[model samples]
Target: MKTIAINQYGSAEEFKEIEMAKPQPKSDEVLVEIHAFSINPMDIAGRAGMLGSPFTDNWSFPLVLGWDFSGVVVEVGSDVEGYAKGDKVFGSASSSHSSDNGTYGEYIAVDNTELTHIPDGLTFDQAAALPIAGVTAYYGMKHNLDLQAGQKIFVAGGAGGVGLFAVQIAKAFGAYVATTSSENHRQLLEDLGVDEVIDYHKVSAVDVLHDFDAVFDTVGDVDTGLKVLKSDGKLATIATQPTEEQKHDQQKQVAFQFTYGTGADLDALAELVLNGKLKLMVETMPFSAENVIKAHQTIEGHHTTGKIVIHVKD
Candidate 1:
């Protein structure tokens, strides 16, 4: 099997192509032939040694550089009952308890609980973008918010991968959605049912939005959302934790998002895709060592509209 591994940290150029034996599954695991994988901010951060010695910690040198994968099952362990040979599956390969290493290879062995069967309406490219970005969106907007109809919610940075998902789910939950995007993404945001598309490049959120309900901050800097929130409103952010000063107002709640993958959550996300409610935007790249470098460059560039996926099989 072929794999991309990072020998050292720094630039994307550090990714190198290599050969390794195909991995085998344990009694509770399944072996998947990877079709596609996506790059994420955590991949960049982990590769840069910012995630606390990924080079020497739970993940060793020449680590596999991804976790989001969509693939076909080729083998299943004796303990696995939900999947079989030739089943299509996608999700984070890491188990709930184990968070290191990744799925950037021709084959991966993940616990059966860590993967989900892909529905018939989806493609590998779209499924490949769903694990981290989709779950994070679901966690923040669906799990945390006690949303009600006629209430207004602001999804900050609504043009990015997770932000796009935030916009759709907030609407699905019956909230009037407002979001921040540049002029270029105005139509797209509006098409996603946004009531107001704030041109964040021109003006700040505090200048335009005064809220009565909730705020989902994907762009970090939760203080801006705090400014416009009503005294009893709630603020949700996936980026950084709200500071003490920002949380001083007792009437407003500052919530931090810690998203994790589960089979039920991934299946619900697939249902949204099949039901024509959620569409994951992605830029597909051929899976290669060189393209891995280019994908990292795109992620760090900070202007990606959605997920950047590498088509691993075809």
Candidate 2:
């Protein structure tokens, strides 16, 4: 099998193409023939040795570093249930590192419980893009912030991967969503159902929007997030966290954490995709060595308006 890995952490420029033996599924895993995957900022963060979690902490070079995937099951574990050969599956990997396992390869052995069936009508590219960003946005709104209908909400970095999904999910739940993006992304966010769009480069979100309800901060702007919240509002940040004292003094639901991907969370993302309730704009790139390098370069620029899909195979 062929895979792309980083022998040393620095930039996506370090990705090395290597050939390795295909892995067999364990008793609780499935061998998936990967069809597609998404390029996310986390990928860059991991490649740069910036992640604080186990995903990147203490990781050595020549590591396989990918997470979200959409693929077909070629084989299944003996203990797995409700799944079989030739099942179309798509979901996020429960664990990631260089040597452990990753999605940036021709095949992957993922725990059965960690994946969900792809919706009948969705394409591989669409399914591949859903896991990381979709679930993060879904879980952030549904579980972390407990966003309610008719409430006003703000999504910082709303043009980025997770923010694109966050805006759509918030609208599906009947919330009035305000997102921060540059002028380039205004139309895109509007089409995705964002009620208000703030230009983060020119105007600070805190200065312009007096928020009620929740603020989903994909950007590292917890300080500004606190400034814009109402007394009862919550702030959920995927970036740096606030101190315990800050949370206490704010007197709101302030949480700083990453999305712990679960079966239920992945299902919610699929349900939204299957029902025509959620819409995502994606740019697909061929999964070649050249394209992979280019994808990393584009991601590093941090101005992409939607998910970047790596078309791995059929």
Candidate 3:
């Protein structure tokens, strides 16, 4: 099998392609012939030796680089009950902090418990983009903040992967949504149902907005998000914890540290997709072992409109 992996943890240049043995599923796992995998910010961090060293003994060398995947079940393990061969599915292959390697190859072994059937209407490309970012956005808004209808919710980085999904999900759940983005993404954010689009380059979130019920900061900048929260309101962020000064006026501050894809949550996300309540924003390039370096460079550039996916068909 052909796969892309890291021979060393240094820069995007360190990523290499190799011919590797394909994995067989255990009793609780299903073997998926990967159709597509999407890139995340964490992938760049890992390639840059920022997420420790996945190539070290403390971790694992030649580590697979993707966590989210969508594909068909080529073989089903005996213990898996609800799934079988030929089923279309999508989900994350590991936890957020997982050091167990991942799904950046022609195939991956996924636990049936963590996999979700792709929504009936979505394509493999769209499904591939949903698992990691979709699950994060869903759980972040629905569970972490317990956002209610009519409540004001702010989403920082609204035009990015997770932020785009967050904006749609918040609006679907009935919250008035405000988001931040660059000039090019303002119209896109509006299309996703954002009530207000804050151009980060034009005005600061602190100066232009106030009295928010909750703020979801995907940019990892904690201080800026804290400035806009209403007194005693909850604040959610994927990175950067809010400080004491930032939390001083808030009744509650909840930083959504990490969330992994689950069967139920993925199912809910799929339902939303099937019903047209949510959509996937995909930027795709060819998937090949040799192109891994180029893929990492694209993700590191941070200018993608949404998820960046690699199409792999063995």
lDDT digits (tens) for residues 30-93 of candidate 3: 9888988888887787767676433233456766777788999999888888888899889887
Q: Per-residue CA lDDT of candidate 2, range 101-188, in tens? A: 6788888888855588887788999989888888889989998888889999989888888888898999989999998888988988
Instruction: State model 1's lDDT.
Output: 0.83
lDDT of 1 by residue, 1-314 (tens): 88988877788888888777777688998888999999888889877877764333456666776879999999999998989999999988662222223677888888855479899889998999998888888877767776777889888889887889888877877888988889999999898788899898898889888855898898897888888788999888888988887777768988787675588888888899888888678899998999998889888988688899999885
Q: Candidate 2 — what's its lDDT?
A: 0.83
Best by TM-score: 2
Against the true structure, candidate 2 reaches a TM-score of 0.94
Q: Is 1 or 3 the stronger prediction by TM-score?
A: 1
For candidate 2, which ten residues in a row score worst on lDDT? 92-101
- Compute each candidate's TM-score over C-alphas: 0.93, 0.94, 0.91
Higher-TM-score candidate of 1 and 2: 2
lDDT of 1 at 301: 89
Instruction: Write down the RMSD of all candidates, one decimal each.
Output: 2.2, 1.8, 2.5
User: Which parts of model 3 have CA positions greater than 4 angstroms off?
Assistant: 52-58, 96-101, 244-249
CA deviation > 4 Å runs, candidate 1: 53-56, 95-101
Tell how far residue 132 is off in model 1, in angstroms: 0.6
